[model samples]
Target chain A: MALTDADLVARVLLDDDHHAFAELVRNHQSSVRGVLRQLTRTDVALADDLAQETFLRAYKNIRSFRGEARFSTWLYRIAYNAFRENARKRKELVGIDEEQLQAEQDTRTVDPALRHDLMHALSLLPLHERSAVLLCCQNGLSHDEAARVLDIPLGTVKTNVLRGREKLKRTLAAWGPN
Target chain B: MNEMTEEDVLDRQLLEAAPYIDDNGFAARVVSRLPAVQRQRRSMRGIILVGITALGSAIAYTLSGGGRFVNEGIVRLSNFPIWLLFVFAFGSGLVVGACAVIVAIRKTPEVRNLRRLQS
Candidate 1:
């Protein structure tokens, strides 16, 4: 059987063995980086810097891992907290304008028009709503799990998913459902 | 199968289109720095321990020879076994050494806890 995450993390912490950590990082890099990219949309360089910083912080703090949640969930919490700190430091509040949202919508060349509408709808959303939607829809997390990672209530997670979907439906209608 | 709603379709696209970035030896770099940091911490612990050892021996000798006060209790306690004292000193030194190394080698609070837990 493959080494469980807990076992691997224990090894990483006590032994300073990067073998297990490398496995974890390799497996989750895309998902973790996707979250960073979504949060820091305009700054690729800053996003990359923050992504590395998040892993470094997580490794540094891994010994405090009490196994209160799944390791992936704990890692997500770290990423979320790190992103929030960077946002606060940079004063980069997400006040997404419709025009800029439309421009972001138009920049994607590869996605279908419907996909673009959905992405546009997501861009237009308030930051927390967008995050909840992406974590639930894109990342395939349950509302409860997303709420745990976001440290919000389960009800709020459900509400955000519902409202986010409804907004996407309206946006797709405007784009005429290709 | 459940229907893929607009949100679902969009999310699928997002994941498919997402870019991957590597951390580039971040873990190795951090680990590399640990030993030197640990060594520095170990020596500091050693100094404190040495000081404590020297102080304890001086106090024992001072009391044994002729302390300023002729307290009877002081006289008896000072008559501790030389063998026992040697053992105690050795044990204390070992403890001080372990503590010194532990303090020096640990990188984070979590790592420190990990060491204690592992032990």
Candidate 2:
């Protein structure tokens, strides 16, 4: 059987095991990178850079992870902080060009244009709503987990997710039949 | 399947839009970027050694007459002439200062590495 995340976390803490840590990176890099990509307005390169920083920071601070939440949630918190830090350094987070995002998108997805539209709309969302939706909607984290990752209240996470979905609905409804 | 509701359709769309990203050498790149763990392990071993030595010393000190030795040592030190006391203080300060300098010199590389990583 594959080792559970808790098992992997234990291995990392007990031995500073890089193999275990690498497994963790492999296991969650998709979600971390995907969420970061959406967060960065589909800037895949910057997203990957932040994802790398996330894992490194997690490795340095793994001892503090009490296993109260899933390892992935803890990682989301780190990844989110790394993204926020980068944005803060930039003073303002600007949306990237759509052509770049459209070219980089996986052609395999059904309705690639709709997906592109969604990605663009998500990037245009208020940062809080974008993060909340990406975590709870895109990444499938529970509202409470999203709250923890966002360091926001449960009510606020729910609000952002609801508001974000509503905005998406209205946007899609207006743009229609793509 | 029954037609999906707006909420359900939106949720499905969100999932489809942000499907699992592939590794595509990302994991390898991240793993490669990690700082060498052996250095940290070595430092941890050093800390463990110092802890063990301190613990052993404490056990020995307690097993012996801790208070009596402390009082006697203080009295003996107090009995030294002022010039000798000044010399001892100066020598201790110099030793501490030299050790600090050595430590700072040794740490320069790690500091540089941290700055590089930040960039």
Q: Pick by TM-score: which candidate is best?
A: 2
Q: What is the lDDT of residue A119 in candidate 2?
A: 75
TM-score of 1: 0.63
Residues B1-119, candidate 1, lDDT per residue (tens digit)?
Answer: 35456556656765554445565764454344333334456679999999999999889869777654557765765799888878988999999999998877655554444433434
| Tens digits of lDDT, candidate 2, B67-87 | 578888889999899999999
DockQ of each: 0.17, 0.22
**Candidates' chain A TM-scores:** 0.81, 0.85
> What lDDT tens digits, residue by residue, belong to model 1 across residues A1-178?
7876766777776566667776667666667777777767536677666766777777778766767566777777788888888888878665566676567556744345554545555666667777888788777787888998889999999998887767666666666735
lDDT tens per residue, model 2, A1-178: 8977777776776566788988999999998998998888779889999999999999888767766677789999999999989998987555434454345332324343888778766776677888999888887899999999999999999998998888777666656665
Candidate 2 Cα outliers beyond 4 Å, as residue runs: A93-112, B1-4, B38-119
Find the candidate with the highest DockQ and give its number.
2
**Clashing residue pairs found in predicted model 1:** B38-B104, B41-B104
Scored by Cα lDDT, where does model 2 land? 0.80
- Which runs of model 1 end up more than 4 angstroms from their true locations? A1-3, A16-24, A97-124, A169-177, B1-47, B66-119
